[model samples]
Target: MTNNMKHIQFNNVSYEQWKEEAIKALKGKPFETLFTPTTDGITLEPLYTQQTVIEKLGDQLEKQISTIRSLKATKDFSSAQQIFGETAEQFFKNIEDSLERGNQILTIDSRVLFDWDETNISRLASILENNPFKLVLQDKNDVILTVFEQIEPSSRKQVSGYILSKEPIKIDNYPNVRTISANTLPYHYEGANVVQELALSLALAAKFANNENNFAEFVNKFYVNFAVDTQFFSEIAKLRAFKILWKAFTKAYNAESNIAVPIVAETSLRSFSKLDEYVNLLRAGNEALSALIGGADVFTVHPHDVLVKPTDKSIRIARNVILVLKEESHAASVLDPSGGSYFIECLTAEYVEKAWSLFLEIEDAGGIDAYEESGKLQRILEEVTTARLKSIEARKHSLIGTNIYANPEDDFNVETNPLFVDVKRLSTPFEELRLLYKNLQPKISILTYGKLKNFKPRADFVSGYFATAGIVANQSGEIDSIADLLNWINKTDSQYIVFVATDEDTKTILPSILENKRKELIIDVAGRFKEEEKEWVEKGLNGFVFAGQNLVEKLNAIAERLKGEQQ
Candidate 1:
């Protein structure tokens, strides 16, 4: 609980004072109503203040007279995995620290080998049954497991571990903690269905919630985790609705549990781009803030370079980003910054209604298993995904540093295993848009084929090799036999052509293209000796390839100089 939750915390500003303040703030600017609508028909306003915010909280507090329940951490049970070995103690320490460091949920990677044996299962069962760390299990089995059989009650009658079940939930994880983890890991991957994911979450939970026999056992213990990506606010509203709807249903059940179902949010680093690694910090920060304000009980800080082998620096940066937001910005200081605004409230209401309606619709379709069988879940997710991608195409969502603020002049090399980034328009003032591409070298098209990789261009581009010049590619069609390639280059009224041959045809072809005096030509072949190939590179090419350098960037820099952007 935060002190801001107390009465008189907002300074109790009345509507009149707030409006007066707004008027003064807007005095210099011409005030045209800039309220806009989102794709979902949710309205967004330019500004928000306490006047518009405080009342919503008051009203909700007044009407919903239930104690605001919260989750607490027991011992860091997530640390003590039943597996003991040389590194087990080290893993245990890391787990404890992460839990105490405020990682509220203890999650298991579903892909691990620990699930392979009965011995491992027993070890897991013991840890889950006794310890706390808000046990989250990876449900990898195609069929969901029933709780009554796998997890028996301990003395306090507590059961822990997510019970993946195709049937209704047994809720037998009580006395300690139990949840479903309602897997949405797929959502982070492109092509995963959003509507299907949300539907599955609801349907799966409902399977347990709707069952009268074990309804108390299941609904009381089950919780879900969601993969939150760059589409910040939608995920926020979606999560909030889940709570209210689930709360509404559970309230009807009249169960004995006091804690609300936990929402463990993992920020999607999948969207970050490795081309601009530093930029990912901004991406991670906003997503973290949104998840926190959206009220996730447990949140994760995924490293920006996670797509690559996660480096220590990236992980440290990722975790520190969260710490800065929470401690420095006091982001979580407000219970729900967007909670009461007419716009956010309206959006939240819309989500609650739409999602709940979807839930009911799923129930009508028999349930999750039936929906999966009918391909209904697949179709729904595809629909949501199409709509989401369309939003990107329409430029409703701006991808800064990509489409919006790309700097063609930056001496950047694309890195392998790129980082994920979510692009949004920042509220900061940018310097005048300098067209960096204007001074870069004209794109050099590489026409190559065969066992020789098209690495010099395509790989160069991906590795952030091109710094000052353009490399256009359709390498599959660029080069075939050297003779034909040379004829094509000769026909070019264009200034230069690089016909690098990768196959046996290069033996016969390389000579013909170089022999043509009509155009400037360069060959980049390694291992096999060719006098003309070396001669052309020396005469026609401007840069060196001696040291495994990313020639794209070097050549681009040369071109940039030729174009007179930089001395």
Candidate 2:
């Protein structure tokens, strides 16, 4: 058993014991109630168990399944290997019971996704086959994605039908499946980015069509996303831009290949009012409407005041708002709700063109992997993100419940009638402290993106990194501007690991640096590196993000944080 496994033996504590003693130790632990983190965030469990899978789907399973299936026929049949009819029958009952018992948001943890001894995909399938849970396959290393071959034709047909089925009801692929989820949570939390999300998606979808072998299948598949954020129009514009870009991207590929790109909208975690908890619902509802009007396929806004432990009342009202939009207000059945306004189309198209251009720029830069390693992609994102942060800090761009209309009195301290925060919780204003300082320090970033053969870039990119970080840089080799920064980056303090980027940054440096240095080094890419330059960057690095983000901003943030420490 793993060391972590040795410690956790679950014997359910009585309410008072869990409340007053056991759960007390967990009060200050950091975890998002819902929505996965896009980058740097905690991964602690609110609770843990050896029996990872909940065997029974609780009480009201039958009714919920009947209701959902009655309303929507299942789509992606091949994907949902729910072979047991009785098990399938059991899932709906669990859903209704969980909902009735106040089990609002669902969970499928890492065990089913990643296990040391077993292949993740099959394991996930087993879990999935047993229970219909909403699982987010965000990590690139997810086990389910074992194959590198292009998606086949049969898969494409299944996916296309799946897309069409989701507009009104659920389909065959785990009729309960939320195939696409918006991952805006992490981007907003860490560096606060959006454009790359649109651009990279454009590139990947295109590459899936043009480059991959399974063009007959995977190319035809259209997946939607569920985004959770508090940005109103910015959120709306994001959805609008996605639709616009998909059209352009598809046009760039084979015509009439739309297949349908849908979006599932959620409220941003960064926007929750720590003060005015109630305003969160309003903000989320607005964001949802924007996504809805912007033509998203599915919409699930989070409960307001989720930053605090949510109450049953809060969840009820959050669902009610959607009900209002769907049933009472009649927002659900609308088509192309924002289709014709010149401002929206023009504005959305502008973002579309910008994203496409960015996509092309990535294509121009030699795809995803090449753009990332050269520090090209990270540098660009850094340039834009830095300006954004400056705007936010300067109050030029406003966050409704956050920076603007300040609420200082503990008036925002919400009621805890079954919704109180963990009394013994950790506290450091996420805005005020470096989350990593409690763990390790960070340094200037040089990303090795996409995939690389070796550890070559570390010696080259940091060539002049010292001077850039205001430290005198000295290198063992030539200090030309081309590879000096990369070499210099390698010289930074090791324990506090230098902040090299993730996607493009990981591999882009391999060939050049490896060849130049003549070193038998290894570049650690995620799995496989795309050979085509333009397509590589768009799909591989996803708009050139590295070090979990852009390089320069990472450098500046680390520098600023370090400088603050010295002060």
Candidate 3:
């Protein structure tokens, strides 16, 4: 009885049957509305199946599967957490704590070496003698090279890792250490879409290989670092696609096609917000897991408060995120955990095709160097950034705790990094709006009209919209006529008043309210009155706050009015 198994059967549904059922469930909604288009120009279907994969891959289905399956021989990866401290002793203590906890790679910024004394240098050298490490030497190579020379020869021989630098350095003594990187975090920060990040990274590596005397050696030593965002499945596909692209890239160069290019993935800070800092933990965790599942050789989960001042607790939590995913989830036990999924396989193939095409374009434009000099890449990034920010403002793109579902009571007075001041983060505009009016305590009132059922919805909408910018708005009692509305406005000391009522009531009541309202009081309407907006503005209405309106522009205008009042 224990060994025997009972057989169970269920009705098999075809794609058409499933579509019919889905349509019935949608309750008259259009089926086409379920389709989503990403910033990279890839349209995502609501459902994917084996047939869908065949349709997408066509003749290359088997080839794509084989390429992705061979991307990683083993699923294991090193946990590399970038350590930061003000002094050498603090840095060493942090390094020790990280290593003792679960950090496998001694990740360091070369800029820190400039402050290290002989004692700390020796301590770091001793750590390198026994452990693997990665040093990021962005424009600090000459000094760091001399610092490396100070390490004992025996220690250098035992060291194993890679160095992330734009300019290659010859460290022949350290045989296991590689000194070239194709880092795409910069592009990610500048708001490049997934395809751009992938293509730029390849173009960057190709640039390094072109400059090197030994192409094969450069390919062998080269590694890539990508910023894994919270796009979940798309991010996983992006990394897998890179592996296929790497193989194709090497084959094009006649180099060894099977060599696995090491990939280091870190959580992107593009979506990190300061208002509700705790939510950043969830964002980081989502990104970290995606990085691991996507087959990163080394992964880093940046502290949730990294954009601001990261505390020791935050850093420890970041380190443990990787530890928990790798240890408890047992994700590393199987090679290519996301392999063979119909949707992901299709996505990987699309990414490979698009990224390779963009790479060829970069090459044709004289590689990354000439492309950068031409400013074409910068202009493209700017356009993408503007579009993304517009999406966020329109509430089409959600960044919980920042642009949507924001916490008005949350404080944002914490210390921030001056260096990250210029990074074009998605939440920065909303955060700035919050910061501008947080201490000002601007008074905003929603002038309710008509029945509670009609006015309540618009009143709540106006309140929540203002709350996103950290301005709490008080709602007035129901008003039946123009006299009651004018009486309420006279008693209240609000600087900004919004008319909240149904479309019909708003059309009838707003013109009268604007005509009678004081000249100093800035007025706005909750519902869209686009056809009569010009007439209303001329009658003394400031603007309109509707569902699809840009919250940034609306909030900025309010902030400017507040600033003018203070002056």
Candidate 4:
């Protein structure tokens, strides 16, 4: 369409030439520093060029990018979600409103035992007469299935849901109902990584696919559920990989090509933070965005405060996240918004390959049920879970408003146990530390001495670090005199005093401030002075807190000290 641009001439830079330029730009830093490796053993390069794509995927590079799809444009791309209520009447009303508010597929959690006198079931059956729906039969004993059984065979044609077990459920009468489901949430909540999650899903699908009686219809009737998190590119690649891997799994069964399985993506409760609850909004939004872009048939964004204190507004915001992404962002209109990108394409391939390997391993171990029963699945999940927790504590991974950039004055007034499911959360440790702060209101005084340049930066750092642990930081403006600083500390009645001045200023004023200090008050320095640390500790210095410090460990030690003092 545009020939004028083709006439433009420029020297094509070789990969080695570009690398030389990049190394020069890096100055003294090692070129290897640009690579980041994920737990799946995929090393990410700083830049992905055409040469890199060709080298990695070979002749498939061009075909891969063009074929990479986040989602297929199927059935007008309506946003689907599950609605739960206390009563059948209330749930009936919710269904009506949820559909009106742009929710295309409305799923009912099958645990709720409705007023099964046929009145409520009749009403739901009447609605299913026209619109499509899903029943989440997470538990085999969920009494709602009784009402479902009552539905006429014709009305059941439009309904779909999982049997929620390894063993297949086949109703002799309602043959149209989908009983086989790829249940991935159990492993997801147990902190399975992206690869493990995908592999587990595939393993479960293969189990159903291996069913001799239902082998032919399993791929068509099967539904997959997954927990989506806020790891932007990884989550996007995860969803896309699911489709790719699923197709490959089905291909072995001689199923139709490009058969897109119905995928339900729910935002991860483990990703929600209780400290700065507002930040959960961002986490949910990112998780929801990843699912929508990755091509999930149905998406559920859990309320930001769902783990602790979910309000009506929070629930509304959670549901509306999908709406906004679909309508406002117009993300639903694109088939694969993240496709064709060198980074995403490469990552997707890596994930698919790794996940396929794990699936094969699971298959070797006699499928998911046998592997899970062997306790190896639990051990592997625990390993990944531990690694993820360590990453958060070490600040290698960041959780805004929980582990980093916390708002000191934020209030966490929710009950210890909310009237909702007690989901496993990654922020539990940080939340416990903040709870101590809320209860004790421990005061930390910053003794800012020397010039503004010497102490201001460290003072701010100290203040923010304590805020993350919900500790109150009372920082005095630059006080050059040791007596003045001690006087301010006495007035504030701080139990912890941190010197925010320079190393030189701290060394000069150390003896004077240490003299006749409060016996119970813990003293600390803002920076590491290894040579002087032992001597300072001998002279009653508590510890050092600075950049790159293990803040969770440091704060936990402080909290323990405070607790002992209180006792």
TM-score per prediction, in order, is 0.55, 0.46, 0.94, 0.90
Off by over 4 Å in 2: 1-94, 97-133, 138-194, 207-211, 224-231, 255-257, 411-567
lDDT of 4 by residue, 1-567 (tens): 677986899998887898899999999899999998775557888888776766777886555555445225253445556665667777788788777777766666555645555677667767755666666654566555566666777666665443444455656555445577787887887889899999999988887777746556665567788888878889989888887787778778876556666777788888787677888899888888888777777777767776654555776677788888888988787777787777888888889899999999999999988999999999999998888888887667888898888887777755643323556678788877787778877767887897898788888889888888777687788787888877876676777788888888888877666775777888888898898889888888898988877778888898788777777
lDDT of 1 by residue, 387-417 (tens): 5455443334554554234444443332333
Error (Å) of candidate 1 at residue 245 is 1.5
> What does the lDDT read for residue 190 in candidate 4?
84
Candidate 4, superposed: residue stretches over 4 Å from native: 1-27, 62-76, 111-119, 160-168, 172-176, 256-258, 308-312, 416-420, 486-492
- Model 2 scores a C-alpha lDDT of 0.42
Tell me the tens digit of each residue's lDDT in model 3 across 215-286.
777866788989888899999999999988988888878865576778887888898888788899999999
TM-score of 2: 0.46
List the candidate numbers ranked by TM-score, top first.
3, 4, 1, 2
lDDT of 2 at 228: 43
